[model samples]
Target: MSTVPKRFEILLVSEHVEDRGGASVEDSAVRSAVVEATGRHGASGYPIYEGHGIVADIDPETRTVEALLVDGRELDYGLTALVRTAARG
Candidate 1:
């Protein structure tokens, strides 16, 4: 028997500080977002990983729906609430 890979959602928030002028600019922007999100949300003690400015919250024991946040804006309240609740404990 084969098992399916678990899916999880990641919230991405980032800012462009300077015009690096190239793909490096994009890379830096993403890195900054990941660092910030991890610093803020990682405190929740949830399994958080930072890559390309994406902060992922994952629980192997639980299923998580996808959510995306760009520039610190939340597009879905339901997903936000779920994340908040999970973060609290």
Candidate 2:
């Protein structure tokens, strides 16, 4: 594959979600924006360096992050960007 898939197997989702951490990852507002951004805009291809957001030296307000996705031999441009962006504050 060329992109890190946004795939979540049925079993994984059920298990992971149930094992929620101390709190939620995104609030209603940010979550909504994310859904619209990726769901509607089809925006992807944000590069991730270390483990932080895609673009370095950004502020906590940056909600989105960009990173290189590696699923075996696959690269997911959209997933990479999504992961990094979401990682930001």
Candidate 3:
């Protein structure tokens, strides 16, 4: 059986559109959405999303994300979807 990680990492790769002169608007919007989805302070020096038994640590400057499974014993479909959306953006 495949085991899900208690903690996982996500790398945010932004696509810079030359025509737009910088990062795509969609990318910016997605990042903002991710930030807005989170609550609480940054004890780890970065904003984190902790809810529904999941904790997401996001660092926009470094373009990295760390996802930790808290109360959940497994990564459910909803959690997987959330991560996929963030990673794709």
lDDT of 3 by residue, 27-74 (tens): 433222332345443556656655445456655454455444445443
Q: Which stretches of candidate 3 lie over 4 Å from their true place?
A: 1-36, 72-89
**Residue pairs clashing, model 1:** 34-53
Q: In model 1, which range of ten residues has the least summed lDDT? A: 80-89
Q: What is the per-residue lDDT of model 1 for residues 3-89, given as tens digits with 9 covering 90 to 100?
A: 322323343223434455564432333323221224333344444533443445444345342333334454433223122122221
TM-score of each prediction? 0.27, 0.18, 0.31
Report the poorest 10 consecutive residues by lDDT, candidate 2.
Answer: 7-16
User: What are the clash counts of all predictions, listed in order?
Assistant: 1, 12, 0
Q: lDDT: which candidate is best?
A: 3
Candidate 2 residue-wise lDDT, 11-88, digit = tens: 001212444456543321121121112222122433223221112211123434322222223333222222223323
Which scores greater on TM-score, model 2 or model 3? 3
The best candidate in terms of TM-score: 3
Local distance difference test, each candidate: 0.35, 0.25, 0.41
Local distance difference test, candidate 2: 0.25
